[model samples]
Target: MQPVRPAERRHETVARLLREEILRGTYRPGERLPIERELSRHFDVSRSVIRQALLILDQQGLVRVRSGVGGGPFVAQDTMPAALAAFENTLAVDPSSVAEFAWAKCILEPAINAVAAETISDEQIAALETNVEASRAALERGESAVDHLIDFHSILVNSTRNRFLAIIVELMSRSMDRLTGTAGIRHLDGAHVLEEHEAIMDALRRRDADEVRALSRDHLTGIWREELGTD
Candidate 1:
């Protein structure tokens, strides 16, 4: 494989560091980040590279860009929904990226769930239970449980108390939204999906790491096979 160019690597590194800081609460919502010139000086890169990094953060909705007087990248106040939407919009332009995202979820989510089983707090578990009940009610009412189901996975990720995992899984869940959307990729049979969610929650309550991992793997791979016809 060809090596990543130095400029590409620099911007990606900058973006990752910035994302970590943002998620760590180093930057408050609406707080302006360091200017491009300042960041370029700190990183010893061109201002253009800093611009590229800012663009990435903007696309991820971690930062919003404004121009002209007093305009720069600032921490987003409500980032989760915007991040998911922005990430999904990016994936929509590249059909192959959807498959790539699926594979990523398969690999990452199970590990994330395993961590959550060990680290999850009582409050997080309660949130998850609430999500499950909401999903069940929606299904019973003949409404789509897709949103709740997506939220269920997101809660599991957040339960890990790992901000990076939360960010990655948030983006993946939105791609899943597209996969289960009206495009007919495959409609998630709510009843069956709810059963799996309930099972996973039970394992989480028991703090069964191995069981959570196994259940999460099965749950995700089941969707992969059903939707993408892949193992």
Candidate 2:
């Protein structure tokens, strides 16, 4: 194998360090990262090297560049959705992928619900209730409840206040719509969804973590079987 050049190694090192700092919250969202010249001096690398490193970060949605005076790289917080969309599009995914995604959701969301059972706030519960109600209303009007269903899941995941999990759920929802389209599974009527959601909500309200986890898993599993005809 060809030897890795010193310049390439330096670039890799810089990228790793910067990414770690961002994940560790040292360089938080909206904070201006050190300027190219400053980072170049600090890392003892060339400005070109710094620019290349920053370019990589920008591509990953870790930072954004602005023009004019005082413009510099600022750590960006909008990475998750964009990253998810990019992944889904790149895969050229289809409906069966949605069933697989639903299986994954069963694993992740239950744990998320367990966490929310312990930590979720009353206000968050209220907001989720509101979403469920709205979903029901849409169903009653004989409208598409797909968006509402996605919104309901989005709200539940966001209630965990875990950015990482939220991103996964966001990506899953996108894939889910594709799966539903391919399977020809129309949205569940509002009443049916409301009853299911109410059960989940009741478990959450009671802080019954086990029930919450079980309900979440069963719910996703049922949806997978019903909509995707998956076992």
| Best candidate, TM-score | 2
State candidate 2's TM-score. 0.71
Clashing pairs in 2: none
Per-residue lDDT of 117-198 in model 2, one digit per residue for the tens?
8878899899888888887788788786666666667777888878877777767666565545632235444466567778
Candidate 1: tens digits of C-alpha lDDT, residues 1-231? 122256568888888888888888889999999888888877777889889989988878789989999998899887777767766777778877777778788888899999999999999999999999999999889888887887788788888888988888866765576655632123768788889999999999999999999999888888877787665
lDDT score of residue 136 within candidate 2: 76
Per-model clash counts, in order, read 0, 0
What is the TM-score of each predicted model, taking all chains together? 0.64, 0.71
The all-Cα superposition gives candidate 1 an RMSD in Å to the true structure of 7.1
- Taken over the whole model, the C-alpha lDDT of each candidate is 0.82, 0.74
Error of 2 at 154 (Å): 3.2
